[model samples]
Every structure is written in C-alpha cells, then in structure tokens.
Target: MLNRANKLKLRDLRLIKAIAETGQLALAAERLAMTQPAASRMVSGIEQSIGAPVFERHPKGMTPTAVGKILARNAAGLLKGMDQTLADVQSAITGQSGAVRVGAVTGAAVGFVVPAIQKLKKTASGADIHVDVAPSDVLVEGLLGGEYDFVLSRIPAGTDPRQFQVRRGRVEVIRFLVRRDHPLAGPGPLKTADLAGWEWVAQGLRTPLRQAIEEAFVSRGIPLPDEIVNTSSLLVMFAYLGSTDAIAPTSREVAELVAPTSGASQLAALDLEDPIIINPYYHLISMKNQSLSPIAMQLHDLVYAALSGES
Candidate 1:
C-alpha cells in the first residue's frame, strides 16, 4: 500500500538494512552512529508506515519478516544507486576516472568482451572495467534494473524489444564438445544418437542453449539423459570435461578458444557434423532510455568492432 507520498527516508532504509544485516538493534545503531533508542524508533516508524511489522524481535536478536525482507532488498538496490551516483558526480567534476559495469554471457565474455576490455585497458588507462559473466536472464535483469551499465548477451526476450538498443555481435555455433579420448572421439561419423548414453554437463535449465537442447531431444522423441552436473562456469565445465567423460553443449567460439589454452589440451569437439540449431548470437544491449557515458560508449564500440566479424 506504500506510494510516493509515503516513501521511506534514506536513513530509515539504511537502518533497516543495517538491522537486517546485524540482527541486533545495538550493533546496527552503533554502526549508524546513532543511539539504540533512536534506531528502535526508526524501525517502528518504518513498520508503521508500511502498515506491517518488519522484524521479529527474538530473544537472541531479530529476524526480518517477509515484508521486511522485501523492503530490505529494495533498500539495498537504492543505496547502491546512491553510492554510484555520488561516485559518478565526483568523477565528472574532478575529471577523475569512473568505472564501467558490464554484464555478459559466457560466450560473449570469452569471445569478445574480455579481449575488448584488455585492449581498452591500454587506451583508457584510468578507467575501471568491471565484468560479470552470467546467464542471459541474470545479465538482462541486472541491465534493466540499473545494476549494470550494459550487457553482452542474447537479445533479451519476454519484454518490449523497442525498450532496448541492441548491436549485433557474434553468432555462437553450438558445439558438442568432449575430452580427446572420449568413447565417441574416434574416427567415425558422429550421430546425434551416439550422445544418448553419456552423462552431460549442462547449462542451467532455463538458459537458451539448455532449452534448445531440451527441444531437440523432445522433437526426436528422446528423453534427456540424466545430467551429471549443471553449471554456468566455463572453467568448471572445462575442468569437468577434462577429467570426466561428460559431454557438454557449448558455443563453438568459446570451446575453441578455451580448449587449447586452459591446460585441457585434450578437450576437442566431437565431430557431430550437424550443428545445434539455436540463436547463438551475442548482442551489445543497453536501455533505450538511458544515455551511455563517454567511456561506456567507447567500450561499446570496441566490443561491437571486435565481435562484428562473427555476426
């Protein structure tokens, strides 16, 4: 029932977050440089404003109520924004360097963003580049919520397409990869059915590649084999493939770039011949409504140029 008129104050939000984190009024108050009584009053005011209790006062300390947890999460986001804004303002006024927060999918992070960032470091010596590699959903959500400046990911789905400005990047070729000595690594024409028995190292269930794999099996009337492992970490995937006989469906560009260099020299593509038909392209995505900073713009151009050849 809360609205603009009843919005919580910055101090109240901070106090709530502190209380949630510390689990004790005295500790939270001390951290905030306020008396315990004042901190208690602030929590009361917040609870009353929201027409619900925000915490459970326990004998040990305190625990956030469901409503309290929701508010605390939003408070964290708001505080992060405030902190970034202050830093940005200082950077602009003092001609000091600022940071570019970038989120990217595994393929793009490996294939383009990481290299572009390395090159950018030589040119923009003072700027900071922070990169996060996650699934497209996580990256897209962070980009839309202001947690990221931009994302190198698939064209975000389930939203208004026009709300985003997207630059075409590399098209990822879905490759079925395995260790060099895997049972299916011999000199014979590989068949899709040949992959039926081996355990799989899969991406998360909701990811685009995973979904495509699921559909491919369903269309062929084959139930997916029991996945031995599910993860998004490229390193873990490589390590697992190197040590085990698990098959991994991965982007061709990433597999090629990582296999030879990651000390997993025996890792190689299964000659499956037929490529997994999935939309494997990377896009440099940012909000249509948000304007990019000079540094961010420069980095964006670098990523686009680096990835354009593969599109």
Candidate 2:
C-alpha cells in the first residue's frame, strides 16, 4: 500500500483537486485539458493506489468521499507551495517576484519606507511589499517576532540594542499640531507654557512620545495639561482636533505628511519658540544573525540605501 501511494504522481493530485472543485469528471477533464475517458482511467488508477473509493458518482455529478476531501485539501496546499517555489526561483534569477514585510513607526513610514517602496515597485513590479505603521515599541516587537523582514523604528528603552543589526536613520523632531482654524494656529510663535492650558490629544502615559512631552513641560516648570485624551490612533487624534481646540504632539515628518500641501489637510503644525525633539531616533533594524530571503534582502538594501543617501 505504501509503495502504491508512493507511485501517485502530480498529475493524479491535480486531477483530484480539479475533480473536487468541479464535482463532475467531464468538467474536471475539460479544465485539465484531458479527455473525459482519460480522466476516468486516471481516477480509477488513483482509487486503486489508495485502495479506497475517493468519490461517489451520482446522477448529476460526483461528490468527494472523506479520503478524497483530505487528499484534495493537501493537494491544494502542495500546489500552492510549488507555485511559490517557482516564484522564488524566478525572483532569485531576475530580482523580482518575491515578498517582503516591513514595520516602521509612522514618521519613518511616511518619510522613508514609503519612498523606498515606491522605488522598489517601479523596478521590481512583481515584488510584494507590506508595510506596518505603528509606534516604535510595536515596530520593534514585530521585528523581533518574525513578523517583519526588517523594521524602521527605535529599539524600545531598556531593550538590549545588541540583539539587532541596527543602522541609525534620522532624528525625529517633535511638533505640536492643531486644526488650521484653532486659536493657536495664528502667526505668532508660542512657548511650551502656552500649550499647557489646552486640552491635548496624546498617546498612552508610558509611550516615549508622551513621556517626552511631559518631560519638556516639567523641564520648563509648566504644569501638564489637566485634560488629556490618551490614544495612539492618528485617526482618533485627527477627529478630536477637527472637533475641538486640542493640540497633538507628533513627529515633524508626520506633521508635514498631513499638512495642507500634502493633501486636503485641516491640520497645521504650531510655530514653537523652542523645538521639542525626541532623543531616540528610529533605525533600520533586522535580527542580528538571520538572513533575509533574496526578495526581502533586495527591499532591505533599497531602504538602507535610501537611509544612507546612496540611492
């Protein structure tokens, strides 16, 4: 029985999959470009190899038996894996047709990762690129968890930086944002003290951005804003800003990305007397010893080159 099963061919599995999909031998045969009589003979041979009936023939069509369903399911997986193998081989040969997953903080997602993706797609159209934009901690976690081929983000505080192969990117200058029509949106440059009285849209208390803002206020001998909405979602922050007189602190890149020049933006960055820059900038990070697949490496190099200004 083992020897007979070992003799089953790819053609047999494909026929089984087609038969399961179409439900009729004649339809399956047409789909596979085989004659109906040839399909029947092949099905007979398959059943013989399994030593069990794989399908039950009815008046209208055929239905897969329990064994047939299992075989068809496995065949589908095998066929998909075979297709991906071919694609990977083509990618290795031509530098196209592979997938890469990247994680980045929102600022880097807009400033760097986006441009690199655009450039890569223009040349390697068959390459599949995925991007996740979140906070630095989230991006770092994704990078370490094997969810990303590489990430553009900071190593979270207290995390051992030596665990990753890091390439320092750019420092992110913080900016305060408000709706274009807010009271603070007028022409005069304001101090950090001026912002302390307003309702603020901020991330969680423990997030680096939030902590930085708090530290800035503390350093300048100003009380923290008494009313704060804590959230990490940009959409929520935008919605709050649109409806109320609230200030949002964000990276300068994000402020620029959402400014009126980029699109139909209702947000404007506040002109500050002193800039509040986060000390830890984002970096291009990948696992220390793990090598990326060829396609992922291609994108990794493209992003790294953009960071280094070589591209």
lDDT of each: 0.80, 0.86
Residue 218 lDDT (model 1)? 79
- 127-222: candidate 2 lDDT, tens digit per residue: 878898888888888888899999988888888898899988865678888998888887767988889789999888877678888898999999
The parts of candidate 1 lying over 4 Å away from their true place are 1-97, 186-189, 221-223, 261-264
TM-score for every candidate vs. truth?
0.63, 0.69
Worst 10 residues of 1 by lDDT: 90-99
Clashing residue pairs for model 2: none
Residue 187 lDDT in model 2?
A: 73
Task: Please identify model 2 stretches exceeding 4 Å from their true place.
Answer: 1-88, 260-264, 309-311
lDDT of 1 by residue, 101-169 (tens): 999888788878888878777766678879998878788889889988899888657866688898866
